[model samples]
Target: MDALFILTMLVVICALAFDFINGFHDTANAIATSVSTKALKPRHAIILAGVMNFAGAMTFTGVAKTITTDIIDPTKLEAGSLFILAALLAAIAWNLITWYYGIPSSSSHAIIGAIAGAGITAAGFGALKAEGFIKILKALIISPLLAFVIGFILYSIFKVVFKNFNLTKTNRNFRFIQIATAALQSFTHGTNDAQKAMGIITMALIAANYQQSTDIQLWVQVSCALAMGLGTSVGGWRIIKTVGGKIMKIRPVNGVAADLTGAAVIFGASYIHLPVSTTHVISSSILGVGSAHRLKGVKWGTAQRMVITWFITLPISGTLAAIIYYILNLFF
Candidate 1:
């Protein structure tokens, strides 16, 4: 009924919508490898990823807390709901743009940068919580590199361990194993990615005086999880194709290695309450695995394109958010 409540409702709706988009956009991150290796059909992979993502989303809240307090404090935000709305809109816009072009962009970077951009626009650069903001930036920057290194190392170890085995038999075994790894990767993806929406919704609650502290409510978590699961069911075939085959010719063994590396990196970040891009980690892991298998086998052109998108997402999303915030502020 009141202006504040109306704005808060808008934020909740938009945040959930963003989460739904994220699910489909990043679905490839979880299941691309398995699908590429013929471990699962597209439909079956989507279903499995959807279920695992829901379970994982319901399992964590630390990352949600980080999103609530980091970058900028909700309590201190001026017209906080409007700021969040701008950020969500900007992020959603960027996401759709990338998805349409089939670029495996970072939703995490889009949202974080949007928040920072809108926050700075609303209250200037000083409004940001420098320490927490920098911490998240570091996590985003370091995660993909870590995934690459781990993927290279893990696959190299696999190569040594399986060298004497028959190639066809090894591929067959790894294909089956990829199913489990894909599920784990999806689960880990949900643990981190779904929480971003939960955090944004919780921030809206705090800003509207409907809640206290950064603790995520059960309803918020469940709704976000459901939104993500439903989105995953829709799938992202374009992205699946790109991540699965364009980056490299992924064998079953390579899929398993990348899945394991992605799962480990994402889960570790979630455990420490840092948000990392599932897209970046998964793609980088694949790149790492491909390089380990054969230096020239990895498609450097695709890798270069993805890396360019990654570096540009943050600044572009942030600028878009800033522009959106100013426009929204005029009305609200």
Candidate 2:
């Protein structure tokens, strides 16, 4: 054995671990509304989400390529393997912390910030590809806002069109519709979130001189999909509680609206090969629906707390990763 081989193995294990954790951490968001509205039972929803996530993960590689090259070139940094490992560790740690506390934080922010932190630590601030990094940052910031707007408008239209319909019958029909929307949201989540791990793995390969291009290999894609699917089987109950109920008292109609909005925004991002936070997008869509339903019905306290977490995640994770990289440098 070679040292590089061991290091690359560590990167793969950690990246997969991050993806697995992401499945449990964020998959809850995708199905929260459906579960809350009783559109799907919890057990059935998890099974459906797991299968859909795996299928979605297998379907796309564009976002994975962006991750491989966008943040900072792994080959250009000194001790690049350690840098990626630190980023993964920091991201995993932040995700677990938020998940335990039932706060829906952005795994996208955590990983992106960690990569920047580790890269700066390894090669100073000069190593960043300014244009590409800013492009990703813009996507993360804008997508959730778009979700919010779309959710609000779509639900308002729903209100006008369905005003005269029978409430009980309409709710029943929407409940069935939620089943489809929930699966779509979960599939879109898989398309985006699973690719982050694939990107990390590809970066490791490039760093170790195992490959030259940002092309995602077939094994990388499948392994990431499996990891995410297996992790989705272990549902995040705390998140389900927070997202499904705390933001607003969701009816089946509202759940369907939010699910559609989230799915559309996330899938659109994937189509353009940009990474956005599924957590942020889903939650924002719910908030939008809540606002449209009844401004007074929305829980501002929970919304405030989540927003605070979103704003601080990047700086905190970055600082954490930088410290981890420094400590790892000593032992390696």
Candidate 3:
């Protein structure tokens, strides 16, 4: 293979690696509530999440197409092996840092931010699409609020409907429902998250002249999904504990409500080809559920910390990617 071919292969591998980490890091988003409420054991939840995540990837290509063609100008990116390597490394590094700290950071934002930073460093600000960035910004801003409202309203309705029922009976009933909700959440997760990797891989392929259009191929979708599913199976235990157990004590009813609300928001976003953060959705749903009971039930400190992380993720990851690209340019 030529040097360009090898570098392209490396970029695909690294992009998939990021997808795996995306799954591994964010497993807590899908199964955390089910696991916390004892609706599903951790092992079983991970297995189920992994399978559905894989299955979800087979469904669509619109989001992938958007990422590859609309987000950044392909012509402006340096068509060099080292540039790709640096961008991937920057994403991976940011992923690891947040994962280690057990922060529910946005992997989607991290990767996009890294690409933007690397692209700007290589080709200047003109390389990015302002409209595409605005779309992403809108998703980031709107998704959590959507999730919160849905979760709050759904939980409130549940409370009202079950007002006369025994609490134990309600919990038992919702435990069964949580199984379905968890599955739906996993499906949405796959649809949204897997497409991101597909987008990156498709971009790499376009750069390498392996295809004619920026559309994602079926194989790319399958591979990205499978990689993410496998990553979910391995699980991010630290984050799992943080989200599932530590945030608030989840019961079956609240868990089901949170999962359903999150699934709905994510599914809506996916249908619109908007890449929203599953982490933000789930966390906001959890907060909504907690606050539905009373403000005191939600842990303000933790929520504040998570919000701070959310605020910092884009800039921090972007700066990191820019620095990494600068350094790699020295040697490559």
Error of 3 at 56 (Å): 0.9
Runs of candidate 2 with Cα error greater than 4 angstroms are none
Model 2: per-residue Cα lDDT over 1-332, one tens digit each: 88778888999999999999999999999999999999999999999999999999999999999999989899887588989999999999999999999999999999999999988998998878889899999999999999999999999999999999999999999999999999999999999999999999999999989999899999999999999999899999999999999999999999999999999999999999999999999999999999999999999999999999999999999999999999988878
Q: How close is candidate 3 to the true structure, as a TM-score?
A: 0.97
* TM-scores for every predicted model: 0.99, 0.99, 0.97
Q: Write candidate 1's Cα lDDT for 56-81 as tens digits.
A: 99999999999998888878886989
Candidate 3 regions with alpha-carbon error over 4 angstroms: 80-82
The alpha-carbon root-mean-square deviation between model 3 and the true structure, to one decimal in Å, is: 1.3
Residue 253 Cα positional deviation in candidate 3, in Å, after optimal superposition: 0.8
Better of 2 and 3 by TM-score: 2
**In lDDT terms, how accurate is model 2?**
0.95
Candidate 3 on 176-253: residue-level lDDT in tens? 898999999999899888888898888878777788687678788888988999999998887877788766788998
Q: Residue 218 in model 1: shift from native, Å?
A: 0.6
